[model samples]
Target chain A: MTDITNQSLSEIIDNIKTKRISSTDLTKAYIKNIESAKKLNAFVTTTFDQALDKAKQFDAKPNFDQLLPGIPLAVKDLFCTENTKTTAGSNILNNFIPTYESTVTKNLWDSGSFLLGKLNCDEFAMGSSNETSYFGNVINPVKDQLVPGGSSGGSSSALAADLTPATIGTDTGGSIRQPASFTGTVGLKPTYGLCSRWGIVAFASSLDQAGPMTKTIKDCSIMLEAMSGFDKKDSTSINKKKEQYSKNLKNNIKGLKIGIPKEYRVDNMPKEIDELWKKGKKILKDLGAQLIDISLPHTKYALPTYYIVAPAEASSNLARYDGVRYGYRSKKGKDLIEMYENTRSEGFGDEVKRRILIGTYVLSSGYYDAYYLKAQKVRNLIKKDFDDNFLKVDAILTPSTPSSAFKIGEKTNDPVSMYLNDIFTVPVNLAGLPALSLPAGLDKQGLPLGLQLIGKALDEQKILNIGYAFEKNCAFKNKIKKWW
Target chain B: MSLDKEKIKHVAKLARISVNEAKVDSLTKDLNSIFKFIEQLNELNTDKVEPLTSILNQSLRSRKDEINDGKIREKILKNSPKESEEFFVVPKVVE
Candidate 1:
């Protein structure tokens, strides 16, 4: 069977322009594939009718000539879709049918993209693995029993498994990056506010960002151009002028100063990932880029710092979801307090509740100074470490994750072990910096190894240029639908 | 005082959780371990370190506070499990 997805975005666009394949066929293929791979649990809800309807409606009148026009793309459940169920993979708000569209989703629809479904995610985007989702864990398309990293696991798994051409996912601390790494897909977390958070459910307000997850750097860039822009509704949204991300794909990385943070090369790194990083460094040198040693000494404190800060913000932001406002409510209670208590206790998953408790405790008056305040200082140091290093190097490089996907149940019992999943990706969030994860190479297990590139805030085009240039030189596997 | 049972209860109540008696021992142990680990943060000489709530080094930006127009109250309340007369109904308390 010819792999429909192996074709790049440019090739797909050309084919669609010539009417070689209609949008209806493309949408049907994905819907069929998603149905076949339903066992992967890649989506919390599949919008089969909606997908076909959008595909046909846009074909009659496409908005533009973009690569993704009439092309089907899945959406992570975290991004609110108007009149569509957006569960964020949690039961508390499982019935949440948003009347408004997230800026990202709105832009996608405006670009004439078709919707596939809402992919599963970590409950409230809280876990590194998708297991915490009330929808059940998304199994890795690569290795069935292992996990697809989360909370964007469903989106990555959908793309990896050939369910859709691309998808959009949110990264708060590493939701997009880590799962992309695990599933061997390209995921970008632009500067904290580069993409508006106006419609997506809040996790960690300061760190949450939305970006594209796709099969290649070029594809990721195309989708990102459609999703990113200024929004008056989202206060943190940057008002900078925008351009097509793919417009700068040809920018050469010659003489680029690439910084390798020495602190991330800790003792426990898998030899395979370390070897992949060294090989990636060599590849950049071969392309005429210079790799320099850099320091981010405060990285060791990042996980601790992120846990405190993210949860504190999450606690405050999630306060709106009380039983009186929206979402699941508890019945069979005598008093208001009992109702509220039972509702939250029964509604939230173990991981979600644990985070709430941790957040509430840290923000409490007595412990606030010791935990949250101190964490804030460490957070500044982490950002400062990046600022001082970025002054010398145009971009920073790090392993997207410690290792490839672990088995589904391996670390589910140990919450701390799971939080460690964000170590490499958290500091960038702390600094409100832009980062991209591309397939650097494959490890011994033949699973993909993801390499992350960090750029200055709102410098997404630079990272886009860097990612596209690297993909041009690197030998990337054609995205096969069966691989998922 | 070793985070006594009463303190745990208070904390759980503040968090609006219903911790069953059987789960208390395990939760206590877990919290103790986590707290002990976080105690290492106290080791840093952060006397001069300034607390930062936002990563951006820019000054705060605020718009004049005004009543903003918002709609779709029915849409917002659609997720609620129980409602009455267009308002979310909860168990009554005090009187």
Candidate 2:
């Protein structure tokens, strides 16, 4: 008998429908796996008792018509789960149990899935290595001491380790893709506004999007279908009908124009990553897709622009975490002003404070024009680069990150080096475009490397199809040996 | 263009985060390095380009102005650190 925990989401659904496995058994398998994989430090909060009860209820009344029938999922801790402790991997939010549910999680529940646990992430979704997480660094299951790329590190780690069959993560500048790249898994950042920002902890409101992290492209499609929709509460939610991505997934890529961005080939990029990108392009070409050399001229400026824009918005958004409201409040401080300062200083992690400081400096009165406004203008140019390239190409192809997973403490000291990890993934967020990162091959170190597919705004179907085609042909069969 | 200690302190104050006295120098160094990296944007001429405020091209949507939700004061104050009679208790703001 196959391990129930090792099955993909679609297979699990099929088994449930066929009465081969009940939701209780599936949930128990995952819970047992999670209990054993404690070295990864992936879960911040596990709802095993609640999960078992829900799974038992689901088994009692099997609903075969739903998208994710009787399935249990662990999501990133960033999403506010009603009556569950929702920490954004920060001391500030360590005690925040939201009274209401985030729209994305609610949607997943509506589709017949229940929460298994909350996974750890970079504090306030700020770091690339998951080191910023107040809970602790999430160990990449690929190798011990290697970081599960962050701020969606725990989501990637949990998915890779089979602690959860499938999971969801919020991507603000490669939070999903880079971790997915680090771990041998699939992560997609949907077009901005596709997933509502209603109850999720706000980072950079514009760039933050919640998407799926799964074992396969098919599972990704299934999870995305359940996780996205229009919510009236989220002002930026796209007013469009729900997409049937899982049902409509097709691998036919004949005559599709895939753009190869010249700018993504950053200097000092790892040789194996370059090889992985080349291999991805070749596989796409072999499947009858036309690869065109394209130039996104403003790509080099995207990282710097993102630094300005994201932090600026984050500084403003995070201001709501004063001592008065929900979350950690400082014991010291005589006055309201001192209280606010002390609470934030003691509550937030180092990286979060650094970003908040940078945000404040840029949005300050004297430097506003030179920093914030200039970055926004540069952002427009970055977006324009994608818009122009999309005229000649249906989707763009690039390596997800410059390198595979680094050691846990390798780049934590140097913030700039850590920021560069998102160079390839940030521009898509800037353009508010949908992109998918699929593990294409493994490096010499036996670590996984991913190739990214960027689609035009609201054209997620195209990228999903391209990724699906690439996944079927590439045949990346690397799996992590369970040492943890 | 470099962020000095004075500037870091001022920014921290503005952001309502107090920097530890011992860590100010290192924080300044990190901020300076980041600012230096961000200075690359200055090289690119973006005078003609408009600042992008929103990614979606559509104008902001407005619905009918009506009170849709309320009366969940207990729920709203459930997570508050210090609440008294539906109001959040804070340190004295008035002298």
* DockQ (Cα-based) for each candidate: 0.62, 0.89
* Model 2 spans with C-alpha error above 4 angstroms: none
Residue-level lDDT tens digits of model 1 in A1-484: 3756666565676677777777888888888888889789888888889889988887787654765778887899998888888888888888788877888888887787867889999999989889999999898887878788988888888878888888888998888898888887899998877798998999998899999998878788888888999887887787778877776676578999999989888778899889878877887888888999988888888888888888788877877767787777777468888887887877888778767777888898798888998998988888888889878998988889999889989997667778778889988888899999988777777777798999987778877777887887778673334644
True contacts kept of each: 0.57, 0.94
Q: How does model 2 score on DockQ?
A: 0.89
lDDT of 1 by residue, B1-95 (tens): 15556677787788887777887786776666656655666667888988876666664468888868767677767766677888877776668
Which window of ten consecutive residues has the lowest lDDT sum in model 1 chain A? A475-484
List per-prediction Cα lDDT, in the order shown. 0.82, 0.93
Tens digits of per-residue lDDT for model 2 on A1-484? 5998878889999999999999999999999999999999999999999999999999888898999999999999999999999999999988888999999999999999999999999999999989999999999999999999999999999999999989999999999999999998999999999999999999999899999999999999999999899999989999999999998999999999999989899899888888888999999999999999999999999999999999999999999999787999998999999999999999999999999988988899988999999999999999999999899999999999999999978998899999999999999999999999999999998899999999999999989999999889999875788999
Chain B TM-score (model 1 vs. true structure): 0.82
Question: Over the full model, what C-alpha lDDT does candidate 1 score relative to the true structure?
Answer: 0.82
Compare the candidates by TM-score and give the number of the best one: 2
iRMS of candidate 1, Å: 1.7
Candidate that scores best on DockQ:
2
